[model samples]
Every structure is written in C-alpha cells, then in structure tokens.
Target: MPIKYIPYTPNTIEGQAVLDNITRTKRVLRYRENNEVYNRLERGMPYYEVETVEQVGKPSDNLVIRGECLSACAYLKEQGIKVDLVYIDPPFASGADYAKKVYIRRNPKLAEKIKAAETEMDIEGIKAFEETMYGDIWQKEDFLNWMYENLQAIKSIMSENASIYMHLDWHIGHYVKILMDEVFGENNFVNEIIWAYRSGGASKKASIARKHDCIYFYCNNPDTFEINTIKERQYLDKKFIGTLVDENGRFYVDTILTDTLMGVIHRVLDDGSIKNYSCRPVLNVSKERLDYSTQKPEGLVDLLLEIASNKDMVVADFFGGSGVTAKVANELGRKFIHCDIGINSIQTVRDRLVAEKANFTVKEVKDGVNLFRNPQQTMDKLSTLITGLQTKVEGVSNFWLGAINDSKLGSVPVYVPELIDSQQKLLDIPTINRIINQEIQNLSITAKKVIVYYIDIDDEKELKKFIKENNATTTDIELRDLKNLLHETVVNDELEFSVSKEKEEYSISIDKFISDRLKQKINEFNDKGNLQAINKGKKFDPINISEEGLELIELISLDCKNSEGEWFSSTEIKIDKLGYVIYDGEKSKDFWNGKITSKEKPLRIKVRNISGDESIVSVE
Candidate 1:
C-alpha cells in the first residue's frame, strides 16, 4: 500500500505570515551558503592564538573565542570540530536594552577639578555611571531570519549522538519551538523544560505574572542519542504514615500498588523514595550571583549538564552570556568552547575562570577584508596594510626584508603611498623626492634604493624628471603597481602580552591589538552611506589610539590562582567613580577588605573597551 503526506498550513493570515517568514529565511540561508561573497569571507577570515595554561597530563583544552555566534560556529564547522552537547541562551527579542553599572576611581586631584567645573557630587565622594551592554530590538522578520541561520549553522556541527538546549522566554519561545522542529526534525523533539524563578517584576496590567523561562531540548538522532536517568530522593521522615521495611532493610512508604508494577517499586525504591519530576526550584541570590543582568544560575546548568553529557565529552555554548555552561562543564571534567560578542560577557567569563585556576586559551576570529586594496587615509590603516602584506609575503618565502615598518626587498627600502583623493592620482615629484631624501638620511651609512607601489601615476614626465634629478650617484627609485604583488589570504596575528609578579601579586598588560577589520569598520563610519554605519555606528565610536590606548578601555578583570572551575572575581577596574578607594583599597580602612590574593599561581586578564570589544591573555 502507498502512503500520502499532507502539508500543514495555518488558518489565519498572521499565522500564515509567520510560516512564510521561516520558510523564506531557510531558503535565503541556503542561498548564502553558496554565495561568492560569503565564500571569500570564509576563506580570508583570520584565527588568533592567545595564551593558555596547560595541565601536566591532560590532553584536552578549553577555549573562549570572541566573534559573532554564527561566524564562530561556521568556522568551527569548517575546522571539523564536533561537539556532543550544545546549549545556548540567546536574546529573547524582548525589545529591551541592557546596561552595565560602571564605577570610576576617585582621585582627590580629579575630584577637585570636577568640583571646580561645577559638577554635582554625592556625599559618598565618588561617581556612579551606566553603559549599555547590548540591545534586543529587532523586527519580527529580521529576528526570525537571524535565528534560523544561526540554528542551521549550529546543526551542522552537532554529532549524531549530541543534544541541544535552546533557552528562551515568553517573548519568542513559541516561535523558536517551531523553528527548532524544522531544523532538528519533528521526531527528534524531546522535552519542554520549564525553569521557574521568583524574581518578581511584572506588568501591573491585565496579563498574568510571568515567572519562568522555557528550555527546549532536542537530539540530533533519536536512535543513537544517549541520556542518563536523573533521580531525586524523597525522604521518608513523616509524610509516609504507613512505612514498610523491605528484605534488604530499606524503608519505603506503602501505597496502593498496581499489579503490573508491584515488584518494580520495591526494587527501585530500595532506600529513599524516588521522584521523577521536571520543575526545579528557583535559585536564591545567596547561592550564586554574578550581577549580570541575564546571568543563569550554576545549579540550573548543572542539572542539564548532568543529564545530557558525560566526563571528557565536548560541550559548547555560543551565546555565552554569563559563561555558566562552561563553568559547570569544567567542574564536571568536560571540555568546553564558549563564544560571545559582548565585551562584558567575555570579561566576566575570563575573570571567573582565572580565579578558579582553570586553564583555557582565548582566541579571536576576524572577518576578511583587504585593507590595502584602495587608497589609504589614516596612518593606522597604512601600518595595518603593511603588516598584512608582510605576513602574506613571509608565508610564501623570505621575499621581503627588514622589520615590518621598515621592510625592504634586499637593500631596497619599500614605500607605500597614502592618498586621500577619490580619483587615483599619479606619484607627485615632491612625494618622490621626500621618500628618496628620507631613505638617504635614515640609511646614511649605506647607499640606498627606493621602490614605491601605486595604483596610478599622475605624470610619467614628472616622475622621470624627479628620479633623474634627485637620484644620487649610488641611489635608484622605481614604481610598481600594488595590485600585482598583493593577494588576499587567511592571516592570523598573534598579539603579544606580558605578566609580571611582584611579592606574589601579578599584573598583566597588552603590548598591541591589530585588526584590519576593525579599521575598515571605522573607515566605513567616517564615510557616509555604509550600511554598518547605520547599524553599528549609532552605538560605538570608531577605533582610536592615543598615549596608552587606555582611553578606549572600559573594564579590566582578573582571576588569580583558579584551581577549580568556579569563577570568583579577584579584582576589577571600571571607568567610573564607585571603584575609588582609600589606601587599603576600600572606601574606608574599617570597611570590609576585598583585596585579591597575593599568591604565585596561574593568572588571566580580560580587557574590554567602550566599543564592546574584548581581548584576553593568560600566563601559567
């Protein structure tokens, strides 16, 4: 006999729109997977290797990557890395903005200047501030498309025996349930776990007070999936009036037994009565609190990790807000990879893990772009372009010589022109003369030769006259097209950082941060009509560097001597006023002292800037 299949359709127009939206998004995702632009981006993206502490005998290592969740997951897929468990706490699309409280140190000299400037002050002699962390504002269609694409990428990296947990709330939980069905298949749906809490704040209007979040659990394959049975003990103190003792000296409550299960109950409930339940009690503030707005409790993640994964298995969390999943997984002896776009989120995780003496590497994935392909304006951009070119050339062979900024081909010093005009102009006489003279003066001990790369020459007559007139007895200048020499490829720039220990206390600082992608983003904002300018420019300022680049910093946190996975903040610095203190590192000497331990052990530092960008470094 032949079977017939029927397609389900919604009855209402609004409902139909929802279905059409998801269907359209899935098609677009497939289209992008095959698109040329995306293909090039995937090929040219950079991977950074940060510092990490390694255990003496352990083979596996933990990871904390900084990038968009979708891009990060796609990179993982391309690298052939698979995980046994996945858990995500993505934005619920609740149409709200989240902010972080900031505190700045109070210098007496600075306070006097503030008072002189007629700024108001509180009696505490410090200032408090707030900075927006991330936003959850999205059009319904856009939100659905974003979630669909991310879920698709996530599915590509899951093993056949893996399970995934999607955490959501009242805002878009129902819609995501349907989306999950499409991605993981309808037959793989397992359970809808409700996490009820009592942090009461609800609308005073007509709706019922919401006190729970929904976690949808699904597996990659129903036949091969593995899950451990979780059982809780019910004490037989007083509730069971009619208690009975079994042959093994185990006590149990006597209840009406069914004929089909009479023997099963006595054997299973040998000691304490067992309860198979789903709802878990809410977490109290006293148990564990990181002050993160959307942070999840460790106990909640513990239960899920216990049931879904085992020791030495790979676990992952892409929307790693508070890093609770990584923390719990590490405690359970499971390997973890956590990715987050927010700087504060990354900083929180790094500081927490470092204090617990957990060993892990921090890496960054870059979006591909050839910054030197066009006219360069800023000195920073020009420097970055030179560095990129140097890396590309050195990988093939030792074709270039000298250090990055002062590189040369043999004895000939190379010079790249910086033009600001929209129309590519020819190399001017004065620019050529200046380059020749500078090279002659810098390398005065030896005869010098100059090679300049340009897209166009203003005038061949002017260049010839300058070269002939200014060319010294032992010097020669030549011009070449840059396009013929440079081709885009995947590059990884490893940042340098140093840690110093004094009297058992450690201090860390970054030597440099290099990102051509970040520079491109800044240039796009400076120029009008770029789409990202309309999107991300509204929130963050373009990249800027000064004396120490410290002005761009937002927060710094540390984890000193972590032995377990539990993250405890050893010290944190914020760009606000509340962090100010007296000589004892407190508002008053008599107040509670929360000083970091001065012990010689592994150390980690997380640095976040005002633009919501983060970088982490560690030393063992």
Candidate 2:
C-alpha cells in the first residue's frame, strides 16, 4: 500500500486573524490597583525610612516569602532587583491530584480530625476529594490570567544574559509553550528538554504509563545565557600505582622505593634481585564517567549554569513544583526566583531548600514591590536605580520593551530614535525582522492605509456588502483594494466593529497619544538607526552571606475560615504604616503596630513599643 503523506500548513495572513491576535496577546492580565507594590527589593536602606529600624530576626535573618507566585512576581519586579536565573516545576494538570488540609472551625480536636482525614485521603492516594476542593478554589481562566501576569513581571526582572526554565506536564505544557514563545520570542527558544524519571505514575487503563515531564529553556538574548562544562573525575582507584618494573622484565607492582629513609630495597621471593631505585615518577590513571539520568541531571544544570550564568541573573520558574532548578542554581552559587500557586508545593520547596541548607532571603512585596529601603536612604534613589540600570541595559531592555509594546499592535513599527551608543549603528532591524518573522510571522494581509475609528460604530457595512458581492473573504483583499475601504470614526470602549485583516502582507503599527516632538525624536532614532545605550558600571563581586538569609524561622499565617483571611477579630489594635495590625486572639483584643519581624514566617503575638524603640522588645 502506498503511504498517504500530509504536510503541515502554518497559519497565514489569509486565515483567521482573530486567532492570530489571540495568539499574539500576552496571556498575563494584571489588576492595576493590586500590582503597584512591586518596587523595593534592594533599592535602598529601608531602615532610614524612619528614625529607627527594628531588628526582627527572631525566626532568623534568613527569610522566605510565602505567597502566591503570581502576586510575588509583580512584587519582585517593582523592587528592581536583577535576577540571574529562574526554574519552576508547576502542576502538570494531567488529572494528577494534589491535596491540603484546612481547619473549618476553632475546635482543635475537630481541626485535628479534619487534618487526619485529609492525611488519610492523601495516604490512600484518592483524587476525588482533592479535585473537588481545588476546583472550587481556582478556575481555568483565573489560572491562565495569573500565569500571564507573573510571566510579564518575570520577563521584566531578568538580566540581559539570563535564562529561564519552565517545567510542565502534558496537559498545559503545550499552552505554556505557545505562551512562552509569544512572551519570549521564538528566536529565543532554546530547548524543549524531556525529563524522563523512574517509577512515575502508572496508566492502568488502555494507555501506557506516563513517565516524563517537559522543560522549556529560553534565554533573554542569544549567546548571552550561561553554559558550563560538565565535569568527570580523572580516576576511580583510590591508591596510587607505582611506576616500578619487576626484575623478570615484566611490568608488575613493586615497592623497591618504599623506604626512603633506609634507602634500601628488599628482594622479592619470585625475583631475587635487589633494586636500588628510589626516584621514579608516580604513576596515575584516569577514567571517564557520565551522568545517568534521562531528565535534567545536576551535571546538566551545572553545565548550563557555567555557560549561561551571569551576575544577578534572574531565573524564573512558573512551575516551581520540585524547585530542582532553583536548588541547583543555589548550589552552583546563582540567584533564583520560583513561582507556583500551589501552597503545598511552595511548602515542599521551602522544606527542600532548608534541608539542602540553601542560603537566600525572601520578602513579600504587596502589589508588585516592597519598601526594602527608602529612596533618600537608598544607595541611589529609586529613579536613579531605574534610570542608571536602564541606561546600561537600555539596548536589551529597549528590545524587550519594543517587542512587548509592539505585540499589542501588529508588528514593531520601523522607527528612528536618538542613538545612545555608537555601536548601535551596526544593528540591522531588517535582519531582526527577518529572523523573527521566519519563526512567527503571518503572511496573508498588508495594511495599505491606517483608518482611525473615532466612534464605536460600524459604517463598514458597505465594505462588507462589496466583499460579499465580490465572492471573497475580507481577508482576501489586496493592499491596493484595502485603500478603498479606509474609513475613520471615533470609538468608545464598547463597540461592534470588525477589521477583516489577515496576518501577513504588512503589520499595522498603532501609537497612543504622545507629543509630536517626542515621536519626532523617536523617529529620528529609528531613521538614524540608533542603538541602545551601552552599560557602563563597575563590576562588583557577588556578596557572600551565610545561610542565615534563607531560613524560614517561624511563620504566623492567619485563619479566618468563616470569614476572610484579611478580616480578624481584633478591637484594641491599630493599623501601622505597613497596614498590619497586631492582636492577641487568645487573650484580649488588644493590638500593636510594627513592621513584621520576619517574612520567613509570620507571628501572631503582639509587639509592644517602649520609648518608641524596638530595642525595648526583648529578644526572647
């Protein structure tokens, strides 16, 4: 029988452009009101924000932020700290069950029972209860939105030479891959490494058992990410072999030079020859060894770090389930950031890091940033940090900005702006366009002219009628034909109008309202083919801090099961600048105001202020 072959046809401009738009749009959506807190990780000396800075390292100076990864990413971005690498192992979403226990009432005995029930179910490995509980807490749309928003912030915090590895299972891996391609360009796509592990779950029905996970590796820029050489020991033998030969003219083990002090050699029974040789070069042998794991091994990670690792590389992992990447990065002396909404997974990662003795610091940034330090007390002001870093990584940062900004429109418009560095003259946008388009461009329709619709009404009925009469789809119109349909009207937020535009031909460039002078300046840079400003800063060595920074001393998580996590029963407490109130739930409803002593774990105990000085609060 002859083989019937089929060829893949990629999306084109003549196809459904709406789908194209959907594909191009970043998956992350942010609630602006909630994302503004991402601004103060290490920007300044926060203690100077007031006269006195309280030292609350009771749990330990080492801290770990315990919160949702989506919100965490935004907060980290606002801090303006550069991350070197990120690795996360998120839910595979392949119907695998994850469970956690929650106390429903104030009864400790009941809580224990519930906890025991939860534990029993987990031990039994039942999926019913877990699915039921988790399903009610999250929706598909919510997950996708949260994923997108965090990915946005993740992109912002990475250093130029950084790389990110996102791990996923079969269910959402494909969706995440497509989203990743859009966020991190197709050009930046590095690898889709399959992590094959031993003793995975079994598929007892009609299908084969599953045994592997997927890891998507992407870089901020080509040739900029880290790559390290894999290492192998030189030999397997523990004892050194001698270079001496037997008197019988055969190479054999001999100890003629065993006694250097006596300078004597004892004759062996087999060969009655006394050898006076005392000076012989020591002999050594070497052996080669290879790592034996199908999935990413420590050796692989080590190699990647060696090659792609850079100073302050922010590695982000949206999955962050096992925290393998983060763990490896930490061991190899690299910075890491991980994200996942799964509370159990977060706790597992924290525990694993603790067990591994990883040294790190964590802080919860409300909105998208934390007030790590005040601007006046900062090594440099917030603006200074932004502008200074911006000036240095402007080229890389601008490229990202342009890519993200242009994604909203069709393509990044061809424009000219002022040149900050002379080396930019060598850059070829056409080449960039060619490279990017080869991987993701649609080739169906071109924009002959831009028609600004000022109103939310469609007078395109005539155009539709014309298209209907012509027996053609609106997407089939040629560039010449497109000019004839050009019309303008003012539009509001809600309207029913459609543009039958195809993906290829020419991309449309839309600009929001900006001063003509600014546009003109940008145009000049575009026309002149200006390049991004070169980074000029002194390279500093990585700080060596003890493991004290990464410990999770004690956390005071709240519980308001019948109400909300935000609402607590407290009357005698006052809200502080940080918006937190201290209250004694067991005793009186009295409260005190002070910044959290540590974020590794929260405390519910009230802190008293004496002479408005935290020193008065005894360490005990």
Candidate 3:
C-alpha cells in the first residue's frame, strides 16, 4: 500500500507569536479546554487483576495493560499503588500516520528460486505489505489540555520520592516542559537530558537538520528524592591522560571517537571489562529490535532507570510502545506496570517479556473503547456509517466533526464522541454543558442546528429536558443514538481442522485456515498504481496466494481446557520472522513440520495472523 507521508511543522507565523508571548510571560503552558478532557476520569471504568493465566514467565506481580494509562492511573491511585519511577514516550502531536511493516511468511512448498529471492529482499525495503498502527494527529491547543490531564493523573500515583521522564521531539517538547513544570511544580523540575540520534531526515539546505529528543525529568519531592550519580568512563576522557592505574591494577579512561554521538564517544578500562553505550536509535541489525514502530533503544531506558530508581521499586510506563521499559525493568529486578491504548502494543510487549522469561500479568480496562477491533479501524468505519459526515471543514471549528448538510436543513453541525477517548464519548451533563457554553459559541454563526451522537447517555430524559430549559443558542438540538446508525456487514475468518485420538494423547491436524483481513491487504498491495511501481526502478511481480492461506498463519496455540472462560495457553507454536517456530515458548528450527501433537486433550485453538489479527476455534 502507498503510504501518505505528511511532514508536520508549524504552518503560520501566528503560532510562533503565541509561543513567544507565553515564554515572555509567566513560565506556564496554557491552552483551550477544547473537549473537557479532564472530565474523562469521572466516566472511566476501572479494571484490575481480573485473572491470572498460564504463560511462559517467572512469577512476579508485574502488569501489562491494554488500555488508556490515565484510567489505569486512576485505578492505581485508588488502590494505593505507588510508583517510584516513570518513563513515558507519548505521542508528540505530529500530524502523521505511523504504520508497521507486514512480512509474508516463507513457504517450504514454493520453488527454491522464489524463496531465495524473497529472503534476500527481506533485508530492507519492499516488504509484503504495511498497515497503519495508529495516527498521532491532533489539534495543538487540544493536545496540551490532554497532556495536562495526563500529568495530573500520573502525579497522583507517584511515590513521595518518585521521578518521571517525559520523552518528546522538536514538535511540542518545549510546550510540554512548561506543563510538566506546572503539574510537578517548578521547584521539583530536575534535569532535561538531550538524546541525540540520527534517525530523522537530513536537512534540504534551506534549514538545519533536527535530530535530538529532549527528556524532561522531574521529581515528586526533590527534598526526599535522591538521584544516583551513575558513573560512566566516557566523562573521564581528559582525566585518563593525567592519571595512572590504581592499586587494583585497573584504570578507567574515556576513549574519544569521531563516528557518532559527539560527546563522550567511548570508554576503556585496564581490566578489559569495558562498558560503553551510545544514546542512539534502535538499528535494524540490533539484537534488541522487535520491528515494532516507534520502538526506542533499551540503552536509553537503562540510563534513566539507573539514575532515578533502585531494585524492587515500582516503575511505570504509561505510553508503553513496545514494552521496552517493562522488559528492562524486569531485567533490572524492578517491578513495573506497562500500559498503552493499542492491542498491537500489548501483544508485542507480551511476547517480548515472555521470551525473556520476565513475569507480568496482562490486563485491559473496562472503558467503552473495548471493541471487536482496534480504535483506528472503528474510527475509519464511522465515516461510512454516518452519511454526509464531513471530517474536515475550513473556518468551521473542529469542535464539530464537520457540518452535515441536509436538503431540508441547510447546514447542521455534527458532534460525534471519539471511541478512543473515554472522556468525551459519553453524552452526559458535562458534554451537554460544553456544547452549550463552550462549543456553541465557537461554531459558525450561520449554523442553525446541532446534532450530538452518543453510545450511552446519562439520564437522557433529564439531559433532553436540560437542553430545552437552557436553550441559549437558539439552535435546534437533537440527540441521536450512535449505535442506532450502525448498519454494516461483518465477516469472520473460517477455521477448519481435525483432532484424532492417539495413545493417551490428542493429535491435531491443520486442514485449512483462511483469513479475510490478510487477503484484503494483499489485494490492496497488488492494486498499487502503475506509476508508483515504476518508481521502484524494477519490475514488481505480484504475490499469488497458492498455499491454501498457510502463509498467513503466524501463531497457533491450543488452550486445552475443559471449559472456555479465561484463556490459557496449554500448547502453542509461533512462527518467527525467519520461519522458525517458538513451540511452547521455546525457539526451534525445523521442528515437527505442520502437524502438532500434544498429550493433553485439545479444547480450543487460537490462531494469529502475520497482521496481528487473532481468531479462536472450538473443537468441542
């Protein structure tokens, strides 16, 4: 699929003026309360330690959550769960869509020439397909309000001596630092660490190349907080020239290098136990790479953890992209909590921690965003379900999705609650009051009607009566049930298999597995424009699916339970990027071909595709 790469930067000089004015005044970040983001905590449903499952990890009380961290923090604060350290890399309000590269699994049934060529091409560009994981697009003022709420919620659950690190790039780091100062207190502001990397695009001669990301660190209480001055040999570069070896026959020297990371390039020791690490991006050839988009290097997290926290202290990462924080925390003997808003992130982290034998429990919040698919797909489907709902409109405020034009009524502004955002979805008194007091005043003066869409309403009769009693806008107000407008067909992948009884064991034979989503992605890939393929400077041979859809299977597991309530992996096999199998969480190459035999009775089987879509099949 062709990716629409949109570069994000400040559009007008007015934005610079606004920022400069804020800097000239008091050191604080201010923004419009666009959607009443702080009210989301009231409607948030908390979920905690629902159940434990059998997985490949050691026993510990660590957690991996698949929901919004703000809600999770609310629950943690109520339960008195205090975190000593936090390192989050939240979205930087960039108007860009991020995608993950999907690879086609190698097939033994295919010809040797095709398999060899495919394996060679896997080193770099031109993978099988790609799918959007999430979009980091947001309005400038609205993003600040959202970040402010998150900071307040996170501060409530931090321990007395806790510390936090907020990672950001050139987009909005300066503004977020001011917000951090307001929430954490200006006196508690500790340090701002600069991590220089070479991942972004080089400058085009018109401007200088921007490459570093700022990490704003703060303490809950500077008086009680004690940060360790972690020793590194690189800072001793000039000192090594005038010093000699100590009595232990060992000397430390900061060796200088000119390759990358200009400051304190390397280190050396007389005992040959040299330890050196550069603040860099995760390279493709690095062993710590999991191919997850926006994944940060482990060394980056290590340096922060070493300075801020100690062993056994609770460390939390709200924007846990790929679980690098949780994995490193567990490795460093610290308890951790990993939370995010994407299932793909949860799955990626789960598998990584499992492979490392790190103990953690999986969790999901009971927010209304719990849907059949992810939030991105659900949001995309809303456009088709709601007729004439415009997503973009000029001069019309974003407070409304867009003014839906009606033949009878000239223009009606539509208000739809975002499924991913829990704070603004429920149509309650706060939502209604905002519409009347805050939003209505900003909308186009010509708009005579306003429509509000909602999944659940708080006291609909009272709300309708409330709107009638406080009709200040003189606009025809209508409340529409969001679910009532849903009219879409659904299809599921068909899974067919067989189970035979052997000597005190059950042997499961995979007959056929079909995935609709994967097939659709392939079709979209082949439908690329001719000019786009020509830009490749080589012939683009289309991929044909002839293996009965076996190439789509990335994971297979049997939850051999008598009844299905909670999922448990009794026997499992996962195909890696190189076509190797991880049987029962054990990596193996050229194992028992396709047929998997288990000594226990198979109850149900779970299959996951290479695109991270999963489905379950019952054998009863």
Per-candidate count of clashing residue pairs (backbone under 3 Å): 13, 71, 0
TM-score of each: 0.52, 0.37, 0.81
Error of 3 at 539 (Å): 5.3
Best by TM-score: 3
Q: Write the per-residue lDDT of candidate 3 for residues 424-444, one digit (tens) a residue.
A: 555776678768876877775
Per-residue lDDT over 303-354 for candidate 2, one digit per residue giving the tens place of the 0 to 100 score: 4454456444445555554455566666756656655433333444553564
True-structure lDDT of candidate 2: 0.34
RMSD of each: 18.1, 26.8, 7.9
| Candidate 1: residue 483 Cα off by (Å) | 20
Candidate 2: clashing residue pairs, number: 71
Lowest summed lDDT window (length 10), candidate 1? 1-10
* Residue 204 local lDDT, model 2: 82
Between candidates 2 and 3, the TM-score winner:
3
What is the C-alpha local distance difference test score of each model?
A: 0.55, 0.34, 0.69
